[model samples]
Target chain A: MKFSVILDALPYLLEAAVTTIWVSLLGVLLGQVIGVVVCVARQSGGRAADMAGGVYVSFFRGVPLLIQLLLIYYMLPLIGIDVPPLVASIAALGLASGAYVSEIYRGALNAVPHGQSEAALALGFPGRSIWTRILLPQAFRISVPALVNELILLLKASSLISVVGVAELTRTSQTISASNYRPLEIYLAAGVIYLAINGALALFGTLVERRLQQA
Target chain B: MLDLSLLVQYGPSLLRGFGITILCWGAGCLIGMVLGFVLMLLRQLPVKPLRWVIRVYIEVIRGTPFLIQLFLLYSGGPSIGLRLEATTAGILGLGIYGSAYFAEIFRAGYQAVPKGQVEAALSLGMSYGSILKRVIVPAMLVSTIPAIVNMMAILTKETVVLSIITVPELMYEMQTMAAETFATFETILGMALFYWLLVEVVSRLGRRLEARVTRYLTHASPQGSSSETATARA
Candidate 1:
């Protein structure tokens, strides 16, 4: 293994690694927002609203995230709206991640028990206040693990944006390998970087899980 | 942004690409099944080194991203003196990626099977192959069918990535036509709709397969009479 080449490539890869993390953060944040709306709509919604949310989730969850990325990055330009790589990546990732996160939120919301919502409603509180204070706090606690999983997946799926020339960690490694013919080493290093990112995420997830449990 | 004229222009091209996507997905899923079963068997083997190989395969595949894997296979393969056709490389990469996934799903299915059933088979004079083929494989298929079906949906969508390697799949076709016509909106929106439709059909098929697998496993009458000869006959 060419340790020196990997060392040389690290500086380049690190910048792309930052882009990966940034995109993942933006995607996960957007996904969580969409997820909440979807979960709430599906749970306390009329038939039409519920179906709308359900269909959104089904479409996003059923397809592969990679294709979704490709569709976003490359296909939009066909119609004269050329989105930058980062924008397209985030939009695609968020849409897909939101579907999964909504499921997690749905499970969490359900775990809050009917009695809780009933108690809030029965107390003569406004419906918005009841859902925000009484139900959401409880739901967030239960869905932590699932949300972490979605985030991890988003991180990996971010690598796919390389197809659109978003110079993320994988692309940087590919560039290095192409120049030097040490793919096994370069790729392995890229894998380690991912492992580090994901490992940190997992640790954070576990800590959050513990905090939720203590609550 | 959408009108009938745009639809008419791109519809046939997108549909044709959809067919190619389905073809690649079908081939990839089938190859994945064979590779997954072989890997699972390797992992389950009594030998220690063979087991390590399986562990390594699973770890490397699951840990890395598919995009990177594709890059390695497509770009790196030639450098290694293994000149592969682009489509062949795509299919192989898809198979490799899907196999790691399928192995995990099948392993879960195997774990779900009752230990008592395996013991009952062993109590009789059933050979390993017969016991596995009759009892284990069928039982594993029950849970695995649903997971496999779900994987098929994912695989269908993933075929779009093959476009990067010039596979002429729907996504690639859409890209070319979009770039060619400067009608980005028409091409991508059309492609997305086709992809959505394709996945919807696969999901329906998957649900049906899953239902059938579960139904058959749950209610199929025992063919091998009683425990005494159950293993032997199996």
Candidate 2:
């Protein structure tokens, strides 16, 4: 609540903001890539691959992202695959969001008229061309709104990574609270920062949703 | 540490926390549904000022992260005169946060109800309460069940966050075990698996309930395109 303390802390908080943004962006980006691949695989592949992809989506979608963070943060290191706190957070979020994004993508794919796929094949478009040029492009458009929702969810989910001691906005505020013994102001500041980030993401989502609609 | 004793020892703690998780989720879901329905009803109220207040309540809760709201209630509510218990705060936070989503669900459910059906009920001179309780509620239930199920999954996960405020939930128990045993991987992995099992069971039940309701409707009434079934199917 102290303006002076927030001002004094602004620079440090900005640094933490970088981590938050990076983790969110990285997680969302990675999730989208994995999601698209999984959905495509689920649509076209053998029963085994489809089942595997289904399991991946179901498990991640069913559980809380916080528990996933704990597992990724703690369990990965035991298998001799140590990652930095930021990396672990990103990977865990990537896996969780990927599950959600795949569902969105699959839904969008369902929306694309089946005739379009048949048309591309009748026109002798290569398999890759048929998918990339004909199917996926249109499917991506239907998915824009859901994708935005997932992205915003990722931004919020990033807050959980602070528990594993990543110096993100939440952790930074916790650190400041401990140092200054002012839990209220610091927590409030962190909340404001989260609100600001989420505001930006939501606005961007709305803009994209509008653009997609116009298209 | 790598055997039956681990199960026999920590098993009780995990089981105890399981009960708390169920309590938190069950109570929170029920409260959220009732609160959400009431909020939805308020949306239909003719009183402008009261409706506006409820509208703002829905927006603010929906817009911000639920974690901050939980923290705000836990820390700031007590700072005033609330003196709420941690579990109580958790339940209230989860319920209120969820009600926003549920309000939207209810709103959509109401909108999706067949207008002609309402007209029919009105022509029969049925009171508003009876119409709602008998007709609209059944129809809305069909459309709203899927959304309620989806939100249920999200709420189940959110209960994990209350551990930070010391709710003695599953997540906190896992954190405790990790700290004491240094078997962080095992404890965390076990915790995640426990969460997976709880949600998977719920998801299966939701799907089954959804299918059963739709089947019962089509078989009993031969209705064309069930409204509640569609909503719940969402």
Candidate 3:
């Protein structure tokens, strides 16, 4: 590998890597909001709501994210919805991630014994307080590591957004490699950036798991 | 609304694409399982350096997106004089990518095998290979089949990314048809159904395998079976 090419492209690639991180962060944030809603709806004990949640999860989970991205990016314009590439990319990633994150949420919620909510209700706590104070906190603690796992997966998946012409880390490396004719060095450098980001995320996840265990 | 006639006309092309997709996925998973087994074995070796090297390989592969890995292999290999056909590159990339996850699954399975059983095998004068072959492998296989099936589903979806490198897989064919027909939604939805069916079949098979294998375990419990099925669904 030519070190010089990597050195020359390091700053540019890092800038694009920042874009990758932010895009993924935004996507996952959106996913969390959507996932929480779906999780709650599915748990609400209404048949129609449960079926809707199931359909949402299955459709998003079953269809590959790349196909979703392409569909959103291309078909939207055909139907006159004209969104920017970034919007389409984030929407696709967020919607797909919502499905997975909702599953994580459901798992964590289930792990918290039903008695906890019953106890809260028997204690005369307000309904909102029962969820926000009693159930959600416990579930959140149990779910942190899984959420982090999903986030790391999302961060890596953001690279697929490059297909829609987002100048993320992978696409940025491809461009630099094309210009410098140093595909090996450039891609290796890009891989290192990805590894660094994910390594930090994994370490953070472990820390959360440990702290949760101690708690 | 889907044009039923268009689907009928495109049925043959989609079937051809589906065949290629399965070929790539099957070949990739085969190579991946072998390499993953090797990696898991190497990780348990007494050599610290070998363990470290295997750990790094797994982390690097698992940390990054498969799309980047595919691009690097497909594009960078030729520059380094490792010329590979598009299909070869796609298969190699998928295999390497899947190996990391498979290695983890196998490692978990290895750890899950009760130590008492291995000890009993050793005390009975069984060779190490025999213990692994006769005892550990069977136990691990029974417990880890669900995880392996889940990985297969993931890898099957991953083959879609291979289309980027010009593999004539189902996704590539569908994308080509979409471009040609400009009926993006119809083409995409049809492909989605195909993928959904494929995943459903794999999942159902995993459940059946779990049911069959659990019968072989002495400590088979209802709770254990349910947990394994839950993991498969996840």
Worst 10 residues of 3 chain A by lDDT: A62-71
Tell me how far the alpha carbon of residue A174 in candidate 1 is from the true structure, in angstroms, after superposition: 4.0
When only chain A is evaluated, what TM-score does every model earn? 0.94, 0.94, 0.94
lDDT of 1 by residue, A101-187 (tens): 888888787777798778878889998888788888788877888888778878988888887777899878878888988886787
lDDT of 1 by residue, B1-234 (tens): 555675588779767876777777878999998899888877777899888888778867876677777777877566567777877888888999999988887777677667888999999979989988998988777656767777778777777778877887777777877777777665566656666777899889878876675657557744322232222111
Displacement of residue B199 (Cα, Å) in model 1 is: 0.6
Clashing pairs in 3: none
The predicted structure with the larger TM-score, 1 or 2, is: 2
TM-score of every candidate relative to the true structure: 0.87, 0.91, 0.94
Q: How much lDDT does each candidate structure score?
A: 0.79, 0.82, 0.87
Structure candidate 2, residue pairs in collision: B142-B228, B143-B228, B143-B231, B143-B232, B146-B232
Report the error of model 1 at residue B59, Å. 2.8
Off by over 4 Å in 2: A1-15, A179-185, A213-215, B219-221, B225-228, B231-233
Best by DockQ: 3
lDDT of 3 at A79: 84
| Best of the two (1, 2) by lDDT | 2
For candidate 3, write residues B1-234 as lDDT tens digits: 767787788778878988889999999999999999989988989999999999989989999889889888988898789889998999999999999988999888888777888999999999999999998888778778888988988888889999988998889888888888878887777777777778778778877877777775646534354454345344
